[model samples]
Target: MSELFPVQASEASRPLASRLAPKALTDFSGQEQLLGPGKLLRRLVEADRVASAVFFGPPGTGKTALARFIAAKSGAEIVELNAVTAGVADLKKALEAARYRLGQSGTKTLLLVDEIHHFNRTQQDVLLPAVERGDVILIGMTTENPSFYVNAALLSRSTAFEFLPLPEAALERILDRALGDAGAGLGGAQAALDPEARAHLVRMSGGDARRLLNALELAVLTTPVEMDGRRHITLAVAEESIQKRSLRYDKSSDDHYDHISAFIKSMRGSDPDAALYWMAKMLAAGEDPRFVARRVLICAAEDVGNADFRALLIANAAFQAVESLGMPEARIPLAQAVTYVAAAPKSNAAYLAVDAALREAEQGPPREVPLHLRDANLDAKSRGHGQGYKYAHDFPGHFVFQEYMPQPVRFYLPDGQGDEARIAKRLAVLEALKSEPKAGRKGEP
Candidate 1:
């Protein structure tokens, strides 16, 4: 079985992240919400009352390190199994050993399963009995959301703690500590990092301590030794160490939904800049341009409505452009449509009117079309289908007061935004005409 905490190895051979793993709670950085004073997890670890729990979060967030720390503090023997490589047989073997240790010597085992979500449901079930009987304290770590990937029964039996990315301050403290520590860090190298270079590493690491340490190690080791026997890490060297900013986005997981939701909401909230930024991020991350175009199309019709009917036209054009052009070129039209919809005078009156009408049509009693408004071309005079229907074109304004529905219902209430203001005014005038006496009515025979 793998050691919970690997023995201190040659600093030259081991990676900086592995060598500098937190040995105690005080040495751990970030996750104050979970590891803060009086916190439940902290209390459990301090009292050796740790139970079956799932540690879930993005990569390089210290899930595995924290589990090792728990084992060290509680004096529990930890057996590590990676769900990616270890199968059902391996899991069963670990459980069997845990049971043997527990029964024979009263020594508790802490089973640390990394990427536990990769284990299939049947494989997960094998560990359930062991966890229930208190044979082993299961620390299942995953990057995926437990509620989505883990079995409901298994999830219910475990307490889930989410680890967030280390903030800038926490990462800075860790960097400073690592640079100054002579035992396991780069202190022996005597590297001096410029402030701008330090900021670049921290920002580019995307709040991942492991990533930060890796970059710092690369910069320090790569730089030539100066006359003063110190290696200076400039911003240019830092840039080369960690070239690209790490973006926490998975096309198939929570990041996908969260990003698109933000994109749509930004447009709805009338923040054109935010909408553009999200769109750029999605496209850069290889999101389908067509999908984004479709969302822009929806936003235009639903949010812009009659306030700016041209927004829908532009969005539709953008969708067509995406279909025809595809990628690189498609982003231009998509951005145009997104920004137009975001900046347009907003109104959801048409969207609300249709939904409200649909609800009444679905839940309320259905009403027949008024006889006057019925088809005149089919047996007109025979059934009075078109009788008493005022010919509005023969009168003033090309409109007349006439019953259109057997049971009248008012659904559309314009918010008087942009073009809808004219619509509201026209409707008000028509309403006044409806109240006029029949004697004073024009073109009435």
Candidate 2:
């Protein structure tokens, strides 16, 4: 792959990232876990025994770089394809070319698919047969989680290596290399960046080396030459060049779902601080505030329940407020609801009770309505719709014991918390009255 590109004498003609990319494992920085002494990947590449594998990680984590390094050392003809633009036809052509090359002179081909997660299931399946047959050694590079995006069968057949984001110290080392190398860096141009500017660049890059280098190049190329005939990158220049860092968030990706799950669990776990932190992250990433509000409402019912009835009201109010007022402002009510729900006494008794009843109903046919409990207004006298119904208002304490169901049934078991405690006591008294042995009365206790 290195020979595929013409060697350019002038470093300024090429992108800083391309010029400074590590050509070997020794040159590559970060990922000590994978590339350290005696690591599996390093041993495989060094021994020229590279197999079909997937390198998955965030951007600027060296997925493609590592793949190229392995191919260079493997002594195999590497064929690169961008999954974003390439279709099944392109994959078929590449596979056939690999087979032809292999048959002609016993040469091997390593297929490097960049952004392999972008390929649909069918496109990924096309590589499965060839990869299994060893027709082409497949190396897939993906920023997304391979488990969700790649075919299960394909994933099972290949080894998956995780490339983590470069740490700050590693990024700093890369910056120094790019600045000091004469042939492939800004050394010949005598470009210097201020300490403050360098710090800003490193921090804003969010552990992405490519982003840091691109911003540095833009700052150097655009800044006017100083009196000493050297380009100086200032803090202001760095800020202007990289106005905003690319957030590590994809709305339709795994991170988005994971964040939301964390937020909901935080609230349910009664951790207000954790809940607020996740909410802030989502809001900063431009998530829908209404979605947060809805989750709060659910948490109130499912977690707080009768233990703090006020929680549900507050959550509902917050939901309405969020609907009326869009974000920035809506974050207030959402935060308020989250805190209230977190502080409220927690109980899942009601949630559990409803689910239990629902399961019973689903397991069998619907229960029939008792004749005494049917609508009395609809021909009550002729059909005896309200037969055997006892009027509770006429009795002492405005309560009467009567069978309301054809068969006995009990679903709700209230937890003794807040107002539910009093309800539980009252239910005990009523149950006692209903169970007291009758003296002489018929159909009465």
Which regions of candidate 1 fall more than 4 Å away from where they truly are? Answer: 1-11, 376-392, 438-445
* Model 2: per-residue Cα lDDT over 375-411, one tens digit each: 8997689988988877786666666777776555577
TM-score (all chains, Cα) for each model: 0.91, 0.85
Model 2 pairs whose backbones collide: none
Q: What TM-score does structure 1 among the candidates reach?
A: 0.91
* Alpha carbon lDDT of each predicted model: 0.89, 0.86
The alpha-carbon lDDT assigned to residue 322 of candidate 1 equals: 98
Candidate 1 residue-wise lDDT, 1-445, digit = tens: 4543346667679999988999888888899999999999889988889899999998888899999888777667779888898888888888998899999999899899999989998998998889889999899999889888889888888999999999999999899989998998888999999999999999888879999999999999999999999999999999999998767777887789889999999999999999999999999988999989999999999999999999999999999999999989998999899999999999999999999999999988889878888898986889888888888786666767777776777999999999999888978877777877752255322
Model 2 worst lDDT window (10 residues): 436-445
Candidate 2 wrong stretches, greater than 4 Å? 1-11, 189-195, 224-232, 364-371, 377-385, 391-445
